[model samples]
Target: MGEVTTSLQRPVTNTGRSKLVRHVDSFEIQPPAPPSHNGVPRSAWARARRRVSRWHRPYITLLLLLDFAAAAVASLIAIETFDQSRAGFYNAEQDPTWFHTVAFGLLPLGWLVSLWANRAYDRRYLGLGPDEYKRVIRAGVAVAATVSFLAFATKTDLSRYTVGTALLAALLLILLNRMLCRFVLHVVRRNISQAGHRMVLIGTLPECLEVYTAVTRNPAAGLMPVAIHVTDGYAAAKGIETPVPVYAGRDVLALVREVGGDTIAVCGSASSEPGELRRLAWQLEGSGVDLVVAPQLTDIAGPRVHIRPIEGLPLLHVEEPTLSGPALLAKNLMDRVAAGFGLLLLAPVFLFIAIAIRISDPGPVFFRQPRVGHEGRTFRVWKFRTMYVNAEDRLASLVDRNETDGMLFKMKEDPRVFPVGRFLRASSLDELPQLINVLKGEMSLVGPRPLPADDGDFLGDVRRRLLVRPGMTGLWQVSGRSDLSWDEAVRLDLYYVDNWSLAYDLSILWRTVGVVLARKGAY
Candidate 1:
């Protein structure tokens, strides 16, 4: 819910029924009839659901065991390092070793309870996103608070060193362990086609297709669309082909059961025939299937959106982006500081690259191009030259071979790029010189990527990207770089601009490391 200001005005729909337009609008379009079920046996869907649950439970169990082991190892290390022999509990009322042994046994159990209470073990948060890590941190803090409170209340001589070390070590171990587990899970999900939730999509054909496209793009999300259930009004809509099995009927519950769908994604404009959603919810009460509503909103991050309940109705409140003020100043300061440090640290590497380039090609080591920055201002962006001296001259001939879509031109195997240039481009070593651009305040470390002046003039919603300084590495670079279409890249950039935050910047930076190392979508 980053401030969504669309140039297109909202079309006037029939609002006479009620404050909320819940019913489906009648359209002349007719959808295709339900296809034959011969291609996909009903049991296949059930097996997929069962397989996902089977894998997920063991994964959760493994996490629980790993959590226990991390806590136990931390406690053991603490006990050995800070022996309770010198620090008696409650004026030496009990033997120090016995008391310490008992504490050690209870510490890990207590930690597990804390983790369970904090929802760190919640399946929804596992294998994706930062919520899992955040929950673990919260649990660690809770454990430390409880320890301190108990010690103070009992007036016991509990060693602070032992408690602090155990908590810190346990938290670090748990996070690292989770990272490993998640990595393995992602690998399995990517390699194993059936390793995910079997979802039945319910909505208009267009909306269902949109959701299907978005979910399938990210295999790590683990939402496999097994089928699509078109709403009543759009059941007869035509002229569109669906990738998955498409079905239409009033008995959604029966459809879900028949297909053994573990999840139902109610996409935009789902049938709302007078508490249609409520009735569906009631039907799914005891069923293991989960109901997820995909709102029409797009490119809105959770931070900018707030759920405000007004008389039981939930309204999404979007906050304006932080383009200026203290946060902006901090971002600028970070760019300069990090750029300066990077330049210093990589001085030798830079020299080696410069020398190599100079020997291999008879041109300048650095390439400077005029690019649009904040507020449509143009600046010379510096980058290690990765193309031959006559590269620009060859652009016209290669126009037809452009592999990318949009005003920008890109060729996966451009003849203009010399032998070493390909390596530089693939490794993104060519972008290292942009540290100079960053240090000069012409660019940021994380923001929308600057467009070359010749690309085209920006207008309307696209211009919103220029509200902030261009970045050396933005969402586009980390997402797919040359692999993403122009529209998708622009959408990501606009999303970044509208949802700028320190945490988001840091997250993008972290992901950039992996992207660069993997050389994904780089040419």
Candidate 2:
């Protein structure tokens, strides 16, 4: 729900919940008529949504710490705060018959064992969306339940204090860790997008148009699609309403030479003769543009697609994503750690920002906007108020000042910003409150920035950005900020998703410092 519109303008949220968004359905873009023997058929965009990492590590770590801390505190209170004999005992000591002193001291070990035994690390639903969080919560509950059932079944002496304390500690820890990871990733992505890498989307008329829309939607991807060109069914350079110009140059070789695209997406099948295709290859032989051809393989995945050179013709193999064993373990480990830390560090930041906002504005410092989070569920996103208390009442009058490229609004000098609000925005202090969002698990520190709930008129076929949590800072934040046009922003975001890596996060964070200090895109 937070974003940068353009230069000379700073557009903040000032609309009421009554304003609804224009949502688009995924109307599968179809290909040209039955493929003539003369040209290749249509292509499918099998792009995978980006999986945030690096930041996830802290989320995991924080969770572990919280769980341990909670257990320790609970044990102390149980052993001293309350009489141990009063609560039903479910003793876990084995043949060793450890003494009370050690048994009370052994809370940490018991808590660890319980955490592992319940498979809190096992994530049956990781990226399928909301189910992932649900699965983890269920697992936590199951672990606690198992311990309780075991204690009762055995009729052994057990400390109810120990079990409750351990469970509460683990839950709090995991949430804290997740929060930390979100911030790390956010900081990291900003750094990555600052690296100088632009993108050029190549495809058929329709496909290239879609690509243009993608590049305009997310700028944190670091790959700015400076220009979009169609490879077929068009003869001249055309504009596609993207932030960048759209050129429909049919000659691949000529386009490659003139436009000099860095990363080329062969969006759909082209009508070039084999000889033209060869010439295009020769022209691009040493040029660094990554020529990615998305063939007519719908429902295909990267794992299923392998490259093998048969003589000179490149072929691809496809495979299905398996859901089991190591994949599950790796995913679980990733989830727990990410969710854990995110909760801890953000806890304090959230407090400070909330207080700051309250000091400046009489209205609630935290403005909660219901946004579509993972899996289309609505979640309230947290942000600091930077506008007049009655800003929403004045939106209709300001609509004319809206410089909209697509679904976004750009107002160089908005009337709604209060005096202190400008500094908060320039320093990005306004976004500090979103750390609460990271804690809610509704957003990430780094990812595509979210869109306003009801502002989806011109976005057209570019709705995929909603597939993931909106980021606090992303490819666009470091690329050019408000200086970037809509096309450039989306290109960078799409590119980030296509070529995401842990290193990219590190890179984005470094660049973010430069952007902030220079105030390149800040208001």
Candidate 3:
């Protein structure tokens, strides 16, 4: 019998950034989450539990299906090709029959089972970024090793060739499957979430605004806000934006009690200390309302924070970011290998683009601008110039026509763009020269987008973005390059920096192809 009109979930794509779908979890008038506190005492684990536990099981199930299919294909191909090739050798490998085929099929089956035993089927993993993939990979390696050991322990001569091929195929298939899952889940979740869960938001006026903004922004999570509780001191200033009605003072709880809200969000930066916080939690429990707290802990991801019970107190620990040391080594190797191969593969495309740029405009084909990069170092970012040669000089004249948040300048029809450049930018063909930046170690295949010198002042608030190399197509580019507001751009960049992983980078690149093809919010 609870009431809420707005929908839930975040915008699935950049094109929907300004669509004003209800925020999935804004603070202003948001239902109480399961203990979402920020900073000193972060109950992020609980908040994440609600999120990851829902998705992980489905994600893992998909991975299991992928493993079975990939292994079937690999086993068949390996047995046919490798066995025949070995037949001519003096020490020929044993050929497989139906018995061997059955055994071969069991290899991936065992691997999938191992993955499940390793908690791969946990629900807290679906639609998440990339740690989920890493876990799959880690589990896959262990499972493969176990199979190899079993082969050696037993007298059965399981071909190394078969195992290797199966592993490779499984990895590629899982990667592709994960990307497809992300797209499909996004579509389905956005459509079906409106019918689920009802909750009410009760928080201080200022804090309520923050919560409201978040919930208002992402509506696919299906949160319908029934009412908002405004604090006594600030209730007069509650003239703000939100879809729900605001009730002043402690009576708001009675209002939520009346509506039977499932959630009560307490957003008080200074008023609610540890003891008061627990008291509020107790009240929420008695009222049958799930309690959620919104503190100002921006940019900290769930993985970085660990909670442990010491005696009766819950202690939270935050690990340092992995931008250096082993992570950097892995990233460096990946960058060089991927960049080298990309440069070789795209050589003809580069040549064709150079020719096209030369033919289109008389200006220099390559655009080099001073951009802030890793560790706040300034480097020249390369691009296929998509503007007139004097476009920089012409910025002042077009300053008044900015379509997005004032921090960015855009014209639906920009005259400074050379005719071909419009298509080039829309298709992201203009950013090809960044491969050169990657070669020079000033950029990566996937990282934060480099900012110009004029945008330097904002770095004080968002310095984490410089922890890694800049990229040609980053979260910013794939999410909707020019469509994001200044704040949204920084949020995406920080999120990427805080949560860097090989699988996440691959997802971005995979999504990049779709973003480019769909041509959404690119112009």
What would the per-residue lDDT of candidate 3 be over residues 308-332, giving only the tens digit for each residue?
9898666668777677787678877
Per-residue lDDT of 38 in model 1: 31
Error of 3 at 343 (Å): 4.4
Model 1, runs deviating above 4 Å? 1-52, 80-100, 233-239, 271-274
lDDT for each residue of candidate 1 in 1-523, tens digit (9 for 90 to 100): 1111111212233454323222334322223224323323345444323423456788889998998899988877776786555332544335756665646667778888999999998778888888999999999999989888887897777767777888898999999999999988888888895557889889887888899988888898788887787774444544455687676543565566666678889998784455667667766655567788888877788778898999877788988888889988888899999999999999999999999899889999999998999999999999889899999998999999999886578888888998888899999999999999999899999989888897778877888999999998889999899999999999899989988888889999999999999999999
Q: lDDT for each of the candidates?
A: 0.80, 0.54, 0.66
Between prediction 1 and prediction 2, the one with superior lDDT is 1
Encode model 2's per-residue lDDT on 1-523: one tens digit a residue. 1121111112123353233222223111222222223423233633222122222244445555665665556555555544555333534233324535334445455555555555443322211123334444665676577667776798767656655665665556554554454445445446664332355566665666565554444443334455555554233332224455555423343344455445566655652346655544444544444455545554333444688889987767654433235643443344346646755766786677667767777887766776665545567777678887988899889888886464566576777877677777787877766766765567766666766666533253345465555667778788877777787677676655444344455467667877787778676
Worst 10 residues of 3 by lDDT: 1-10
TM-score of every candidate: 0.86, 0.43, 0.67
* Ranked candidates (lDDT, high to low): 1, 3, 2
Residue 396 displacement (Å), model 1: 1.9
Give residue 228's lDDT in candidate 2 (0 to 100).
59
Candidate 2 Cα misplacement greater than 4 A, ranges: 1-272, 275-306, 316-352, 456-460, 491-510
